[model samples]
Target: MSGEPEVHEEFEARLKTYEGRPAAETGVGRDPVNEPMIRHWCEAMGDTNPAYTGPDAIAPPTMLQAWTMAGLTGRPERAAAYDELLRLLDESGHHAVVATDCEQEYLRPLRPGDAITFDSVIESVSERKTTKLGTGYFVTTRTDVRAGGELAGTHRFRILKYAPARRPRPAPARRPGQPGERRPRPVVNRDNAGFWEGVTRHELLIQRCTDCHTLRFPWLPGCNSCGSAQWDTVAASGEGTVCSYVVMHYPPFPAFDPPYAVGLIELAEGVRIVSNVVGVPYDKVRIGMPVRLEFRRYDEELVLPVFRRYDEELVLPVFEGVPE
Candidate 1:
């Protein structure tokens, strides 16, 4: 991470030579197109399209890059040109890297049991560029993913490798497992102050667009349906169903238990809210399960909204049912 800033004039021309060079040659997929991975992807994306399921199931077209992804060991037969280019950038003090975006074009449908392979080329390397992140070049790679010797898709990926413009603010060391370590506080701005105030009184309030009367969640400043800035608050019934959920198991955070279920509850009013589902084991959390909202006090100053299952008595669901 430590490197002296070198003269940009010395290496800028060298960076241009990397354009149109091979990045990866004949990179093979770690796994063949299969049903289990497709099923998992569908479940997580909440994509219920029948084309992704049943007999004659073709992999989702949007999953073009997914089929060619490399594992931790990295791309098989990766060309040295890309490596040297990145090293040159690193040596020039552009050590931070982040993927910006990707564009995919599907040429053919990829079915299960299809073997995937790809070849990538350095599409372009921009000259010294300065952005909010810092000064560095934007490197783009174009990959042609193939199946059975036929082009199945084209994936264009872009990344920014740059030096940090400024150091990030230091965070206090946190021990989430130990008692009394506080979770980071939420930002209460002018636009969202009312929502937090409603939480204090244990009222789940949603914004209703004054123009179209459409209900919106998380207290948006303007209505998405009609683009109206005028809106009013509507008290939710707090009864809902689990539309989707995820079990967080890694990268521990303050005051949170790992492997916990975070549910997206579709409320009776038709809007959805995301909160922890506490009544059942994390693994037992199921889509379409009934849930009811409740306010929980984590500490004297922190009270959060969580949900409990309809049938399971693992956790009590008590809201006091105050009049809205």
Candidate 2:
């Protein structure tokens, strides 16, 4: 998803305040995922294990990844805000951003009934040298997933926000049914160009780390899990549910006006990605909503993979039962 320059500037300003504040400690809150959520995730991933759906449910290992990133539960709390300098750094327009890389370490298993809290901090921020177009910064946020005040897991998210090639236009008036600008696009390069190329084809491709046999998205030369350098490209089914989402209004991208919805979509193959929900109103794009892949052309070599809603009104499981 993208944001306008002004709103981008404002966000950067606020982030600066968060820089030295120390990752805001989150209080114990109710489990964001309830029974329905659990069922949806299990079904979305085609995971029918009794443990996840049974009365005594043990959460899936990846469930904590979703739970912690949902941000603080209940009302908006300042406990997680970043410093001012960081905020200013975020002002540059960016879209359809992905976590090009991430590292998560699980210390304990999470059961369905466990009440967990994620105490997250802005781990670090580093600037990238300017290439042909514009420049950007990489921000890493580390969150400690805690269950009943005990350590359960730790997540390190590396996100890149870059300046847009074209300047954004003025944001339009709010409309009830539309989506605004999207988030920043993950930085693409020669090594991972094939992955982005797949997006242009409306296909999801993962690089299987040849040495470790791990499926890697957003393309990486070395395995984030095992540090293996060999990798092979494989096609994936571009289908999954909304793991989480955000409705951006403050900063609108020129390509998209206010307000649009950007989501953390977990693909059927188990790779979680960031994109927008199309062919449906933003208000209706709820968590757990099923979506299918669609290709978007951004210039010549660049194609973006976005999602469109699938429901009774629109058939879901679009890629399911289809031949591989």
Candidate 3:
């Protein structure tokens, strides 16, 4: 038998030994189901369903795993076998891990004051396989959650512990006067074509429903409030404040610089728009800081509206924000 193939088979056999073993057992939720967590979850998700509020409020069904979270210190009941299995994969060069997907099934609703317990098992470990993210095996865990010893839900989570694939950098565009590399073009269809056109003319136009006199951003085909298809344009006052922002630093792309700030700006018109916040460092972008509109031309074919801090001196037009 070939030595390398024999080694591979032995490794696979070792991994299979962990399948169906307990990943976590006798895991008790740190907090009982309550309104404060429910309220926080609803607000973060922008969910306003009345069923989640008032005295009769039940926790969101998807919060099944939330109750079982180990937090920074992790759960005491977590088995060492699961950690050992992951260590083996990391030793085999599958050191990077990203959650691929999850599935949940709810059997009963959980209400305030319900104490939760869960047991998780290592459901399966796939044979070594190659993916766009590089070669790795899929690890799936299933957690059975219970309330007062009654089955409440099952959550299945899958992750890819992979070695990232190397990608060749795209060559710079050869055209004279063109930017080094082209940014991805915005998807402009009939619904949002006017928005792109307005950008080309150096205007940030918000859509207003002619029927109900409601203003909306991103050029929705119909009014969300009144369901009116008839709409007109209103020029943005070019003033806004950062409502929320994120600094991206992973899975680097060729057309972008890392550690950039992408802000959800609350416009003076009462609508919110997401664009890059420039002038200040990414880490310095704070909610409630004022920003002003600016148009940046990537190439002859691409022009986008971005926001700069209202306090910074205007710098020459450059690609400094998230792609629209």
Candidate 4:
């Protein structure tokens, strides 16, 4: 594939129309606090608080004016970023790009009489990769919602763009008569016990801080998000991109081999985690590779998500400016 990005006119047209625009100014938008929208939000969140449904319903902190907006389809411009990424991947032939992680922050609650505007930007893009099947790209979009000109919320959306494999690369081969590297067993704690158990089931788990309502990782006894002692374990989608990573040249553990890549992956569940990356050669690994969660079974009750190099077969001209 060429290094030059093949800009789709249809995608650009949609982006130009939606960028820096207000929904109200465009018409055909719903009021966030309107009865129907509010009820829908309440039901969607399974929140039964009278404050939201009562005559004097105080809007929930999680509510945003953008929540009232309906999903789009007819408007080719709607989801312009996602469509653009998909088109890029399809053109390249890596089709396995998938949603892995998202992080949202509620700046303020949606209230009656608030007119909201939404603006989105293509925050970042990653280098093209050669996966087993084809080439792929990882794209991130940041969408901001403003109520009455004040920041109401922010959504960080990520997608994988894949295309058919043009130059199929061989998968990593295990050394003959050599066992795979081993990772030390981690002792379960009260806070992380559930998380470890979930991993065995090939599921990701995060602790929700009751006090601050923030999601905490690494399974702390107290809420790392809010310092609250009360917490709950929530299941997470075991998909994410490599937020940061490193290839260790030195062997500190007997079970680990030299030149293995360790990465901190940002999951779609809004949590970041550290794990080993496999399935691709060490030299090809880079930040933001579009990886699917693969569970490695250890013994009877242990499983963990190990990232494999994605899109290892499609060929693309070398790209610059992506995270290493």
Candidate 5:
């Protein structure tokens, strides 16, 4: 009764069957929501809100996923249906995987000593679609967390499993001895245009919520605390320490060289920004190493902010790339 078998139609039908299947059942948290973990998270994120501290402290709403993590040992209660679905995709040639995004909704505050548990389901599977990364189905999983048998929050995580598309970028046309292609410009919009504008004037600006006065970087339109949209700018002290860092060694882009250190700099003003850590060997870069701000010109047209250690001589030609 079937004509020539449809290629993707049959595969998609099989995927749809797995939707609503159990992903995890009654997954218990390894530890109760407590103060130490909250303190560590706040330190790493440079969050100084007093609401997260003191005897009356409550866990940050963003820590919803932390209490549910299974850690290095892996989750024991994970259902097989999710694994089987992923295996089905792997066998069908969509092998590479990337987490596209996630969202969380908090219903109530989590207090210390509160026991936590969660259950997850394969929420949805999208029909086949092509993207710049490649062609694949988007799989979404929804996890509901409970404290003392009461719903506390929900987390929705989405990922793309696909066979990567082959992309061949040709060399840019140039006269002899000219520099390589100029660096990828950071995407500037209404929310972040002010930050970039400060860079032009050799100043680093951090956003402060007018209501709660909590400082934040990478400039969001509204404060995560109190949801206040009113904000003001505070110029940074230019003194910072390398809170964390990673060295990029593979998958070189056109405007960047491999084996350079990128760091999360914690400024004296209690906010963090990401920038290239130059003037030192990549391996020599270490956490807690002090860094200071400096603006470097890559060419006549582009200039960017970078941090350098006090000991190393200034280096030229550091670059940052915008991912496709």
Candidate 6:
């Protein structure tokens, strides 16, 4: 409202000029459709379907845009009109860019030896809108892909060019004895309701398959090993060893202290569970340290199993017989 009205009007007029204009046309793919690229794509996606391999291979439909990429040198087919539109946005302080989403439609399969080509047009430009990232415009472009002179796919991509908004820093974590702060609530569904119920009663329960005798934690309805739905609970021996651990330090949250140790505890029953390793400094927590399970009440309603390491004095004697 404070700036010159004529200048603002000129900017809007320039942006509208790009709509329905060619962003890129008569663009030829740098490489022909081949099996090697398809194999690499399938391997990276963990897609092992037989149709994507061997003599009958067809490139994955999602690779429609990959064929038309400009690479590091950029596309010569791009029109100067698209570049001018972006330059105008940058001049208006909307410099940052992030791709929002994309939609694709495949009409025919792309097979080996098929040459690829494409044409793209500026689809639409949205009115200025305010978002968490800041105020910006949404620009959309639609590309039509052709293979062997036939329509193969259509891809629509949208991006937001914005001036980023500043976010306030997160609140500091509350101290151990502070009031008005609680741990994040656990997600309890029917599949794991029994496990949470067991915790409320100061019991650590593991599910055991009734048919195959295999035990699993984080309770599930069916046994993954045998696909059996029959199962029962077993009380743990309350003994375990620290098999692995990690220290969290970033993106501090109000509910958790930074630089705390979370460990994967291998229980004596041959199953593993994750819990906070207490009774020792976070930095001192090591793999294979013997620990015993105990219940801790964070507040009146929450009680969880935590592992406590044996006192350092008690563990030192066991290592005294060996050389340092």
Q: What is the lDDT of residue 108 in candidate 2?
A: 82
- Across 1-324, the per-residue lDDT of candidate 3 in tens digits comes to 112767867888999999999899989999999999999999999999999999899999988889999778766988888888999988876778999979999999999999999999999999877888777789999999999889999999999987666433435643333455467789989999998888889999999999999999877899999999999999998999999998865445556666578999999999999998887778789999999999987667777888988865445554444432
**Candidate 5 lDDT over residue span 140-171, tens digit each:** 99999999999999999998987665433545
Error of 3 at 106 (Å): 0.5
lDDT of 1 at 11: 70
Candidate 3 off by > 4 Å: 1-3, 167-324
TM-score of each: 0.51, 0.41, 0.50, 0.39, 0.49, 0.49
Best-fitting candidate, measured by TM-score? Answer: 1
Model 4, 140-230: lDDT tens per residue? Answer: 6676777777777887766666554332222366332234434566898876778877877777778888778888787888865556799
lDDT of 2 at 225: 88
Q: How would you encode candidate 2's per-residue C-alpha lDDT over 1-324 as one tens digit per residue?
A: 244678646655544445545454674444544677678788899998887766777777777667754354443322535534344555444332335457888898776557777677776665342433345666777778888778988888877665543334444773322343233456878887788777666668888888778887667678998997878877877678898988765444444554567889988877788887666666567999988888865443445788877676655543321111
Alpha-carbon RMSD of each model: 22.0, 25.3, 24.2, 24.9, 26.8, 24.3
lDDT of 2 at 45: 97
Off by over 4 Å in 4: 1-182, 299-302, 311-324
**True-structure lDDT of candidate 1:** 0.83
C-alpha local distance difference test of each model: 0.83, 0.65, 0.85, 0.62, 0.84, 0.82
- lDDT score for candidate 2 against the true structure: 0.65
Sliding window of 10 residues with minimal summed lDDT for model 5: 315-324
Say which prediction, candidate 3 or candidate 6, comes out ahead on lDDT.
3
Error of 2 at 33 (Å): 5.6
Better of 3 and 4 by lDDT: 3
Ten-residue region with minimum lDDT total, candidate 2: 315-324
Regions more than 4 Å wrong, model 6: 1-10, 167-324
